[model samples]
Target: MPDNMALIEERLKLYMINLWSRSYYMGTLGNMSKEVVERYIANQRTTKSNADHLSKENSALRH
Candidate 1:
């Protein structure tokens, strides 16, 4: 089984690939600016933090 970090990285890469492909098809390939990349990074960080919090809460409840 893959570790948590590895799994996250893999999923992130897949998501980026899908996003880029869609953008390319929509003719927004050149419009991908730094702000967009930063937003994506921030979104990923928020998602990971939320997932971690949920996992901790679930474990605590279980115990």
Candidate 2:
């Protein structure tokens, strides 16, 4: 049903946000996480004009 689909969509969005928040938090935790640093560097090297959504969320959480 439409209601069920809507509920599923909402849950999926929440799950994605949860995952992004965790990833971002882990990335900011410390300098010893080499993998996180490499991933961040790789993301920075990309030519995308818009800011990454998860990065934005991570920054907002910091303040």
Candidate 3:
């Protein structure tokens, strides 16, 4: 399996490529494609939610 830093760097490269490609195709720096942005936002929300839920559950179990 790939090491953690390598995995993160790979993901960053992919994200930059997506953003750069979208910027180029749209011909504007501010014009990120809605779908890509939405997906990114949704994933962020999901990760936060999951983390919060896990923390709550762990705390409850400890009590």
Candidate 4:
């Protein structure tokens, strides 16, 4: 019975540690995803601005 109890306690500790590590990893992933989204948005805006500029230039040349 004592051995079984010790095994149970060890299992519980391992489970708790695994849970904590997974949560920490998820938090880091969330932060990285946010940064990636911000960068993508900034890049999208820059691309749109460049496209608009090129369109205007093309129009001016045609005229």
RMSD of 2: 11.6
Model 1 lDDT per residue over 6-63, tens place: 9999999999887764232424446787788778768978999999999999999999
Give the runs in model 2 whose Cα sits over 4 Å from its true position: 22-63
Q: Estimate each model's TM-score.
A: 0.51, 0.35, 0.47, 0.49
**Cα lDDT listed for each candidate:** 0.79, 0.73, 0.79, 0.80
Give the Cα error of residue 8 in candidate 1, in Å: 28
Which window of 10 residues has the lowest lDDT sum in candidate 4?
21-30
True lDDT of residue 62, candidate 4: 100
Of candidate 1, the 10-residue stretch with the lowest lDDT total is 21-30
| Model 2 global lDDT (CA atoms, 0 to 1) | 0.73
> Global lDDT for candidate 1?
0.79
Model 3, residue 12: C-alpha shift (Å): 34
Query: Which stretches of model 4 miss by more than 4 angstroms?
Result: 1-32
lDDT tens readout by residue for model 2, 1-63: 999999999999999887764235554567666786778768866734345766788899999
Candidate 3, residues 1-63, lDDT tens digits: the string is 469989999999999887764222334436678897778668978999999999999999999
- For all predictions, the C-alpha RMSD in Å is 12.2, 11.6, 10.9, 16.7
- State the lDDT at 35 in candidate 2: 86
In candidate 1, position 10 carries an lDDT of 93
* Of 2 and 4, the candidate ranking higher by TM-score: 4
**Runs of candidate 1 exceeding 4 Å displacement:** 1-31
